[model samples]
Target chain A: MTVENLNNINNNNAFKVPENYFDNFSQEIETRIFEENIKKQFGNKNPFKVPENYFKDFKSDISAKPKSNFAKIIRITKPWLSAAAGIIIIFTLWQFLLTGIENKNNQTGNNDSLKSKNNIVIANYQPEINTVDIKYLEPEINAYIDETDADQIYEDVNEDNNETKINSDDETVYQYFIDYADDNDYTELLAEL
Target chain B: MNAAASENKISEHISNKNFSEAFNLIVNQYKERLYWHIRKIVIIHEDADDVLQNTFIKVWRYLENFNQNSKIYTWLFRIATNEAITFINNKKKKEEESLGTYEHRLSDTLESDEYFDGDNAQLILQKAILKLPEKQRIVFNMKYFDEIKYGEMSKILETSTGALKASYHHAVKKIEKFVKQY
Candidate 1:
């Protein structure tokens, strides 16, 4: 064989391809190119889609969630900050409870003064009885009566026979005295007795 | 049609918004040459297919911006070359392997390659080509096997013709020594 023939033999490809590769290759290229063009066009036009007014609805959806400043603060601070907030709340509530109790006691004292003011009627005072001296002796007399036996007191009163006969003279006299006491004239009657 | 007439028709069709027709014409005219050019660099049919398709897609995208004075074939080859280099670099990075190690792996891959039906001499030639540095290998493949002129290679590689010639010469010397040893 000549040098040219040898060169030609060596130039021939020893590599092989799949059956009918060349026959179908051009067709494959066309198909791929066609698909690729479609893909490029699709890419530019956005293949993904959403419902109508999607962006408007999306804004509404985001707005629908709790967006108050307080809620936001709680959400952001929930990790460790919320514990401090809870402690502050508990301490404030305890302080409020303490102050409320103190205020209630002060109001009760004021109520007593108000009741005394309302009850004082200077026009109805009895000139015969000096109620100030009686008020000064009332505490010591109550103490002496509390120390004495009730039966002994009643026996002492009965020992005054003239006073008992005068009291038993009218059977309905006890009912009249009780009715007068109910009318709030007991202070004057006590002074007279 | 002649290349000039085809370029005019493609340009006219593209200007008229007939992209599919223009792009299809471009693919039909250049797909085989681009495929082989990419295949030689990547050394795998499947990877070559991917790079070729990517090259055409880029061409289609940048068609409007194409310089009317330059030949479409030259522009297409340039895109195919860049895409092939980029693909190789990305594949190497993904595998976390250096270019030399990747080339060695490709050499091993060629042994078991079902697509490669070359005999001992052809396989040795391929092995010798793989032993060259990546840039030299590309220069050698284009000049030695594809018989592409140094000036055209300069356009595709964006290097001077002088530099490409030197690269090809060095690659040929190395391949000769390698083939002699094998």
Candidate 2:
């Protein structure tokens, strides 16, 4: 069909919604919201909660002792700087989170989605990232990955673990991904990636 | 609703970092409005839900930057619309990348246990809507489902009322024809 005709088809339908379908949407949203709430309060992937000791960490006073000239700069830029930093941290964490998720999606071929007690298992067992961590026997996979690459990744994870002791449980998945990558045969390809 | 209480409630939410308070307040006030606005475009509850989450997340992220030049609710509606449009656009891109037509993707989605919202008629209407250009879809959604007047929408969207009204009419007529055909 022509573009005009398709537009006509869409205009003709105009997308009428079922009456009151949205009426109970508040309740459904509430349930999901509570889920988000629990996730946040427990520090389990809740995007709303900033961090523990946030008030203490973010506390600052310009007027209390601001004779210093540089403190003025700090005062003027505090809100903007903090907001920028928050955005950066959120973005960085999100990238790391998605990489973990993508690795999981590659492994096991979407099986865990059928069973989602909080949708947690989509990481860790993902063979692609795990293959990098775990030691592997396959020669073709060996030809693909250098054994040292997994060791470097392990070193990075150890550093990361020291910096942050307990993160959201997804780190458990990250841990598994590391282990899998260390042992898996195809880890060399991962280095190029 | 007491506007003062609502205002205080939002403030409390900001103070306590209580997202649920803000989320509940928004849902109580705007759930049906936002849902119908979203439902008109996406048609499926699941897609709507994902878009809705994006909308709320946008709200949470941007609430600190709210300028108060327009109502917060209107700003939220704009974000919701943008998110839905982006989602649909991305879905189309994904299908194209997978070497599938829109019809095939729709069937695959429907056959799956994931996205059906128990209303086939609603689905048909949304499929028709999927054909409209993004601007027409937005105008149609705001004017028809949400019953927003052109003037208010102009203020929200920073567009001419006449242009919006014309877009709405074109959108309406196209949808009417499509619905009539089915």
Candidate 3:
């Protein structure tokens, strides 16, 4: 077409700006720059990748790894197990204490019973001395009296108590012998006298 | 269950000396998140897996020492983050390279990695990220990819929020400039 005809004709090929294009031209350029900068720095892509099923198997892999001995022990020994062990130890100690106390009590009871039995024997034996035959003891008593020093016996009795004197009566002598002699020795001495 | 309730239950289980069960629960709950976090740091699937396992093993060893002062996930993240960083440092030491040289070499290896299935642009981004200072790189990945909040990150990285913000800002600027130049 001729130049004059082209100028008169409608030229749809001519460049045109969209509505308000210039109004936001600087803002638009800034936004594009921002986006382009971000894209250049950190493209919308993850460079790192994993083998397929890596995450799924990771747990098993970690679990399969051996643990430290202390960790293993910690894992194996539950709280209840430790508590139970503590309880058993305490119970064993309690039982030992109870058995010790019981044995001690048994020993004390035996000693007390032995003492009571000895006391009973002494009580039963006392009457036997009273029942001794005086007739069988008369000759021994005469011989003993012949060998004895009556003056020394009176002196010993006077030393025991200055307020009292040895009496010549047999009842007074027998009473003095009973008061001053051992159970078996007194019986023999009394029989001889 | 809510986080507090779940934490309380786990704490109860641990306190009750049910270590196996408690540990199992912990592993199931945190393995994926930790694996991803470690993977981003180490940049290799196998290394990530190893670091993740080490992190969990540490958790198993020190689970009793967890005072519950922070969220369980935050504590876990801390362990995972430290393990990843340690793994990288050890690798760098083994290679006998400076930090920048080792990171550059590691980024170079990403192309041949069988598990790295990413676009060229993504690879470029990752390489740019690796070129950053270690702390800045971590802060960027955690804040950018993981979108972990600054507060939570403070607990995990043991850095003050203000310092982390500054680090992140610097990292983003450096990364953008690098990517634009590339």
Candidate 4:
């Protein structure tokens, strides 16, 4: 080739690319750099596989199984069970108190009825003698008798009996009378009338 | 490791299957310059990308047997140049047959290489280089464009220094005639 012609290659400017061809190039090199990095990283990582303690945190969960169901019941239901026990105790105590009160009330009713009967029986018969000695009668009967003056009590009772004085003694003797009174009113006594 | 012996230690580490260390060394030493060099040769961003991958693959595969006889960059350049040449040859083979004469052959290569997105005169110059023989084309690229010394070029090409200088000179003369004509 001619040396004068060689001016063309030195004027080698002929084969130049666009102005910014190399300046503002694409990220291909960066991509290759990354690809190389990944290759390098994976190449190193491939040969290593350690026996790591993967399940360290799972120990508590495993241990808690089956036994934890029992424990959980205790944990979750402790307050509820305590509340139930408290309610049962309260109900039992309430029932017991109610039954005791009912029994006492029933006894009071029975004593009232017995006292009414005693009053009726005493009404029909007057005392045999005046100033009857209290020492002679049973203490229990005396207590049951309400410890009032017997003469005024029995007189008030029999005078209201409406007995027909058949004989002189009949007025003072035990009279046979029928009672048809709701409140044990001794005044309700009747002979034939 | 400490900087006390990072160079020798890093080189030793590269030989011990320590690819990460080798990669770090490659990045620090050759990354920017190699990228630009490749970018200039292949032109299109994507084609350069493909060539760069093939280049590194070759480098990694042949790293152990690397004689450590030359500059690491020259070793790398040989691989890059080989990959680029193979790619262009394959590309040329795939397309239609090139024109018979040297001048027409150069025109066909530049016209065919979609990556030759250069301005018109630059395109014409590249076309002229493509018309030369394969050895002349490589010598022309190393000397004219890359400004690489013929000594290093001789080492990478495994050619005698005298033959490289002659090839470069002949390539320059052809390119000069072509550029002036264009």
Best by lDDT: 3
- In candidate 4, what are the lDDT values of residues B85-161, reduced to their tens digit? 66655555445456434335445655555545455545655566567777887776666556777778888888987
Residues B1-182, model 3: lDDT tens digits: 65677777778766775555566678877788888889888888878876787787668656656776667899999999988887777777666777589788779999999999887888888888898998998988888778888889999999987678668777777777788776
> What is candidate 1's lDDT per residue for B1-182, written digit by digit as tens?
87778888887866665554666677766676777788888887667755665676567446656876777878999999988888888778667896598888888888777667676566777777789898998887777557788777888788987677567656766666576675
Q: Where does candidate 4 chain A have its weakest 10-residue lDDT segment?
A: A129-138
Question: In DockQ terms, which candidate is top?
Answer: 3
Task: Give candidate 4 regions above 4 Å deviation.
Answer: A1-193, B1-10, B15-17, B39-43, B99-118
Q: Would you list the C-alpha lDDT of every candidate in the order shown? A: 0.55, 0.48, 0.62, 0.45
Question: Considering every candidate listed, which one attains the maximal TM-score?
Answer: 3
Q: Stretches of candidate 1 above 4 Å error?
A: A1-193, B15-17
Clashes of each: 0, 32, 1, 7
**A29-49: candidate 2 lDDT, tens digit per residue:** 553454343223232210111
TM-score of 2: 0.43
DockQ of 2: 0.02
Q: Candidate 3 lDDT, tens digit per residue, A1-193?
A: 8987877665655678666667656654554464468765556566678889988877633434322322333354333222222222223334445544232213323322111221122223343332222212223333433555545444545555664534544345444434533334432222122
lDDT of 3: 0.62
Between candidates 1 and 3, the TM-score winner: 3
List of clashing residue pairs for candidate 3: A141-A192
Q: Return the DockQ of model 4.
A: 0.00
